[model samples]
Target chain A: MFTGLCAFPLTPFKDEQFDPVAFARIINNLTDAKVDAICAMGSTGLYPYLNNDERRTVAENAVALADGIPVMAGIGALRTRDVLHNADIVQRAGVNAVLLAPMSYHHLHDEEVYALYEKVTANLSVPLCVYENPNATNFTFSDELYQAISRLPNVAAVKIPGMPFGDKVQGEQRLARLRELVPDSLSIGVSADKFGVAGMRAGCDAWHSVLAGLFPKTVQCLIQAVRDGQGESAAMASDRLSPIWQLFVQSKGGLRVMATAADILGVCEGNCLPHPLKPLTGPARQELEAQLTSLQLD
Target chain B: MFTGLCAFPLTPFKDEQFDPVAFARIINNLTDAKVDAICAMGSTGLYPYLNNDERRTVAENAVALADGIPVMAGIGALRTRDVLHNADIVQRAGVNAVLLAPMSYHHLHDEEVYALYEKVTANLSVPLCVYENPNATNFTFSDELYQAISRLPNVAAVKIPGMPFGDKVQGEQRLARLRELVPDSLSIGVSADKFGVAGMRAGCDAWHSVLAGLFPKTVQCLIQAVRDGQGESAAMASDRLSPIWQLFVQSKGGLRVMATAADILGVCEGNCLPHPLKPLTGPARQELEAQLTSLQLD
Candidate 1:
């Protein structure tokens, strides 16, 4: 029954190690701000870059430090075995549901794809959500596939990526089609941070969000506005957050931008990313500060 | 100094474990076929999909099995610490050169990027090669940046990507410019397998190759033609292999198609990949077989 704004918090690191103290504070802030859910080890959390020990630590600390809020941990990898291994580790650490996306270097067959979810759901003791982010996974589940996966006993939710990196699904139609096809018991959430207002307004059960981690009030208010169907006010909030979305777009899908916004707002320390990825620099860094000041996230 | 046709073998996995026997066969085949170098853990080797233990094992096995061929190991990760950690493991395994790629989740600045190579190079008793594949790393090096990295104490070569995903740097000019700008002592190599003839004829000191792993005789033949500046024969050989290149292009940057090619030829059994990725399927599978038959690499 996962719903409302599912916050994806950025994993704060210090000295190239997962800093539990700093990360716990970020989780504490989001939970205190009263968001719907706190998700760690997401794309924003740099899950694929982490070692298993670090992932376990992040999941354990995020759940333990999130106070009473539901913590959904992403447990995806390039292989079914590794994905399950991470799922087992996180489930023991007490996450509500493990979010998954099957990432691969080659194109997968439809049957092979179906068997992956079947294998995971068959063994997972807890509920697991399907994260359909094609940009990273290169997989776009057909209507038939979605319907089939929904029947799996432990399937909890389906998170549709808001950023349409490829494939045809977009905007209101995507949410409508998913809501219609997937089993009603599964939560339907939108993950493109910039599109949260519109995604929520479109009747997505939740926003699997990155924005909420940086600007909780703005995102929480957007969630409430959409719930109330306050279209105009929600649009206004979307407009104000437009600058933030623009920065994410410029930075190529929001990780660096979110880190910059979080760093500027004193939400975290050290703008350094896990290397190869520096914090937003040059023009984009300047624009982030400008957007924060304008939106009053500063 | 690593030069000439460097073969990058695909990592074969069985039961989700690295199959050293299958990989050892591929390494022996390439060395026996007389490639200039045997590179383990390159992108073609599926390094990122591997665990550190698997990576170290592959590096050690490739080096020990390479016979007299120099072994270059790819030691890149999303973090500087991990890259160096991998470098240490690979260096102790007796690889000739460690190939460093600055892969990132965030955009990096030039100075920080330069420092990554410097750090890894400084710590090594042996040499390192700069792998500038922007499609994966998302970091584009300037002409100035290339010259700077080339001057590092242990920097041996710069492998520029032959497949231009975007921003257009595909042919002879790319090799010619880099050869002119990079330090004369530093080897200049082209990484696109399809363009071996053109890349070598364009003055690339080496072809860091995937084709050589499976079709070593054809690649070796092409290398000789180009080295002899027998341009017409090299072009003819590349033309016969054009269908093979077409399969790679259809598969998008060639890993799956090459893997399928190797698998079909019985270069290794259990043509398995890390998951999410399956073997080439449908029309592409048929075409791969036809191309192999035509090239006689079958």
Candidate 2:
């Protein structure tokens, strides 16, 4: 079973090139924090920006630095072949598993969604995890689709964002329903680092996070507090981290903000987003720095 | 000056793999048409489904088949690096220009959009064309951004889709306004085959189309009628081909429909959309066949 914190490192680029040394440094930092696994090339990692060659290089470096720890590569695209190609490359690099996100030019039906997982898993040697991030990807698979995908032989987990689905009662009901429906062998992970403790208390098996990439020790402590049933300590940790999370999420470009914060925290050398996404402005950067310091993360 | 008809060949796939031989055959057929150039790997070509190697191979085959005729490759992606990588590969394959779509991850500010084109053109040795297909790609670039992109040193043309902005008065006013603002050196091509005659009458320099891929003679006749000011004849051709266009557009999947139509016409061997997009079903196939017959393209 996959447990503990999973750190999703931001991909580093410099001078229109993938910076391997900077990537290595970030992975080393995560390793030092003893993160159970590393998820490379996720939305936070900007997988779409990396071509096949760059993705292969990143996968190789991540697998090497992971040093026996699990490395789950993000494999999702508008085209299934691109995903398959990336999966093949990452598999060759010795990554432990692949996290699949169903993204495309149009909304997909339940069967189409199931077929994607079925086809990918049929050819993949490693276990697969289904990621449901409806915000980044406009298309969200329905519960029926998720149930079908979860039943696939190679599917091992389902990762959901931790934000409340309207009311707390509905959120708890949905969680309880999913927990009851998903097979026991298929682990359930939450992608919400902001409410990691709360999600854990509500019964998520693991916390998948972006902030964990920058402050793994703090994230680890927060998770541990919840695990140990120390509610007050967990709340304090979450309170301290709230400002940083808000800064990262509310910045003009949310993903770009996380990349920039990673640079400020010394987790990566530079914060550069791919084309169409520019760096935060002077005022935005200054505001983010102020928030980071106020949260004592700087 | 890219005047007259421009054909974008559907990228051929056989048994789920890119069929370069079939792709070459389609290009060879377009040579007899009055097409000024051939566009390979555009959205009509199902570009996102192709892997990097397959993309390179398609470019290579397209260049070979076109002989001295210009072949432009679509190099748009969510990431600047992906676009650059594709541009580099296609340039190496001897493509004349790269058709670029602005970053579609989010609605972009003018400066950010300008920066994307500037960065791409800076690295590209070949000329580039700005493809404005806002209907398919949710993010649309403003007129100011298009004007700025046109001023870039290597930009050669702008490809606009057919849908009018509004009523006749508004449409005419908008076109007149654009003509006044945009320079004459940069040609504007229309990708609307259905409204080809109207667009030509409105002073568009060329027609970029998908229907032209299968029925070159009909498209050529339609273009000739428009050029000759035979409005009734051009309208007749448009009416005849309208059903085929509707079937292609209304089909469940864009790429799948094109590939299936190619297969039905015997231009390609089979439907080869990458995963997440399934082939046409029995009902869809029957409907497409009937539509093609009605258009006299079968």
Candidate 3:
């Protein structure tokens, strides 16, 4: 049940406060779309920007509004004490799982990163996903580190960055190599929304997606096509959004682009991002609106 | 008065709490050495790992215990609102100056970074130091960004990463170029302790140091020799500590090694670092002790 499209939603804010009504609207939209799981507080959810109390409030709202679908929350923080503190909070708030990125200010050693996971996983009452996001966290997990972490108890999945595999042969070989390292019980999920179709066709068990948070049916169909072995359909689906993917690349990462898309779709009211992160502005905003109109993405 | 060796002291902790007594010992050591300034809550101080209230207490103690040494506190956070909030706290706690690093989870655009400094500086009653520790913050500041930020109100200094200038000629030229870009009012400070001697000899106005936190007199002599234009003596002083400098290179930016040295020196009780960060272990610890003894560093 945990191994499918896990949509990461933006924790919308209004007047620098968590906008519960706006948040509920987005949650209800994802529920209606029946995404495999709702991951609140992912990077796209601005987990690091929010305090623990705000995160707990967001987690509770996610669980309460998600209908029967499972909910996961990001528990990453700069300190181990805070991560563990967050692990307890989200679990008590009734999340089915927690995603932990080894968030750092000081670059962490491999031993320290492993120790962080070991300490957190030991305290989890629910399944944990080892989030390996080098772009945001600046800590890359080696293949050996991955195998070691996957051996820890209650580790249900490993969310990996998208691979730039040129073809199915490379994609399959890469996934096959990773598969050999971890237990069969561990689901392999791919993020970097642009590469989800390629990853799904590469035989990844799940797509941890930012796009799916705002446009679930769009990504759901792409995943469903891959599952049904319709390679042409999945490829076409991904190809259709090349401009948006280009925008993701040019914007540095998906967080800003996804937030803009959410606001454009009216899923989040405009100007939803927290401070130090504004929505797409000027040409970028105009380009996004033009693309949405041409793509008929409503 | 703002320029010279600004010693960065560890905010020592005992049992997951700020150990003010131990913290006072480190501050007193820097004060006794007559360092030009004491910068509390730097990366060496584990600022990002500390919460705002904890940071407030650390700043208050630093100002109270510094004995009029011109205390500067780090006020960087992931959000602009929080940075402003911390600015208010640290300033109210009576810091003479505040350091802003533009700490990030998502990599920030240059425009966003400029806007961050703009927002924080607009509300500050005290002068600000632009902390450019890319290794820790993961956001590199361009020279143009430095130029822009240096022009902002309250920006008295720009702390740059220590450049690997091979000789005094290169250092002079590089510093001269940077000098042209910023106003004459801005003091240029260099960090990365291994390169501080070269930077100081090359005419950087200040050395923002980690080693100075634990062994203030040791670093003080090096900076002092340069100030007195004792070229041969300064070179010799730096050359004598080649092995310690090599340790900083191996130990990943001096935070861990400083923590270990602090414990060994009894400046901090053992296990002084916050969780997810540990002091040097195994052979690294043994090697640090051997070097300390050989160098007669107190």
Candidate 4:
């Protein structure tokens, strides 16, 4: 159920409230492109910022509008109870899978993390994706922890941070080590959009992508080039968006940059991110617009 | 309002529901101890696990039971909107201050964190404590960022993680460096129960202590020793509790160990920590029980 390009669209906001119209526009772009899957309420969707009701609204809409594409929604939270609550919400909304990051307030131990997945998976009706997002959650999973969690019921995939930037050999070695630990049934997905193609080329099963969320065709072409074993073509396709990747780094992850690009491209409002997360400003905003215009992908 | 020993009691639960009776029992103990202030709903209270309604329940109960001692409630959340919402709830519940951590799903920039404090403080009716707890929040603050945030309205204090373990000179140096950056009005408090004394001896104005949460007299004596300039007495007091400190190290932080001690002493139920945060078990639990018995802390 978890394979290929998993596009993550922003849960668009206007005037500090959810703008379902703008969200449908984003989801429709993914459906029209026929991306492998659409993952709503992922970190790129600002899952943590929204309350359960808002999350349910996004989940129901994403599943409804994906035009028969499989949908996954992030159900990660600080508590097992809330995670279970979110799992029920997304599952009731008919999402095909749920992504759970062991989000924490106190840093979790390996055993505690294992217990979390064990408890969560026991209650889940859908396949569960282990979201190993250390940057956001402060919980890094060791190979031992991964092996333990992947063996749990309904475990589908593990979404890891993108490999060391541009280091294909290092990426392959890391993937190789992880591959040895988990069963073949548990898919290994990669995030961190800048080096996503490197991870895909290194044999990651899916690119759980932020880039694909905004520019579906662009990322799809790159992934397709790789699937066809056209290495140089894949590299060339990835290279075409180097300027945007640089902006992702400059802006610190894709959330702010994606919102800015979406705003500049007229896909969403001028300042779409939830409060405390401002859209790009001044030189950063100008550079993104200039780069987006040059790419001409919109 | 933030000064001296601000005890943080666990919001004890039973049968998967908040045991307000157990909560009040813990609170009454602190009120009887006359700790300088009481901080309910800090990390030790598992603020992240509870919903706003639950948090409000805890806040209201904490204030009602604190007997005239000032109360501070944690209002930190992933979104600024919710932080404000929590701020409103706790303020209405009559907490003297709110503790705001720049809790993140997306790792925040210095500017973003500043914006969060600025926005939150703008709506706050009570003073705000900057909770610079990197271990849980995964967002570290630069000294320059500290300087910027400390200038905001209602910014009362900064609760830092404990100083480097057993390194008094280093603790003092770190505090000195920080002292130069923030206003004198912002009381600097320290957490990490094992090193609470080191932080206090090094000139921290308060200990936002997990140890004080459960064993108020034990921790208060140590602080009182420091206030009297009896360095040897303070060190001796800390050393006497080395067994529990070792347990704190073994358990990663004071939460599990403290919960175990509370259970063994019959202050709360046997498995009192929220679900997914299991109580200490097997040899760890046995060892803690033996150590507590030997210490005759009960």
| Worst 10 contiguous positions by lDDT, candidate 3 chain B | B162-171
lDDT per residue for candidate 4 within B1-298, as digits (tens), equals: 5789999888887766788888888999998999898889888888777887898899999999999999999988887888889899999999999898888878888888999999998888888889988877778999899999999999989999885636877888889999999998889998887788888889899999888887788888888898999867888778888888888777777788877877887888777877677778899999988877777652
Ranking by lDDT: 3, 4, 1, 2
The predicted structure with the larger lDDT, 3 or 4, is 3
lDDT of each: 0.77, 0.76, 0.88, 0.86
- Lowest lDDT block of 10, candidate 1 chain B: B163-172
Each prediction's DockQ against the real complex: 0.39, 0.40, 0.77, 0.63
- What i-RMS does every model get? 3.4, 2.8, 1.0, 1.5
Candidate 1: where is the Cα deviation over 4 Å? A105-115, A134-153, A163-170, A281-287, B105-112, B164-170, B281-283
Judge the docking of candidate 2 as incorrect, acceptable, medium or high: acceptable
Question: What's the residue-level lDDT of B123 in candidate 1?
Answer: 91
lDDT of 1 at B138: 62
> What C-alpha lDDT, on a 0 to 100 scale, does residue A76 get in candidate 3?
96
Of candidate 4 chain A, the 10-residue stretch with the lowest lDDT total is A163-172
Between candidates 1 and 3, name the one with more favorable lDDT: 3
TM-score of structure candidate 4: 0.95
TM-score on alpha carbons, each prediction = 0.91, 0.85, 0.96, 0.95
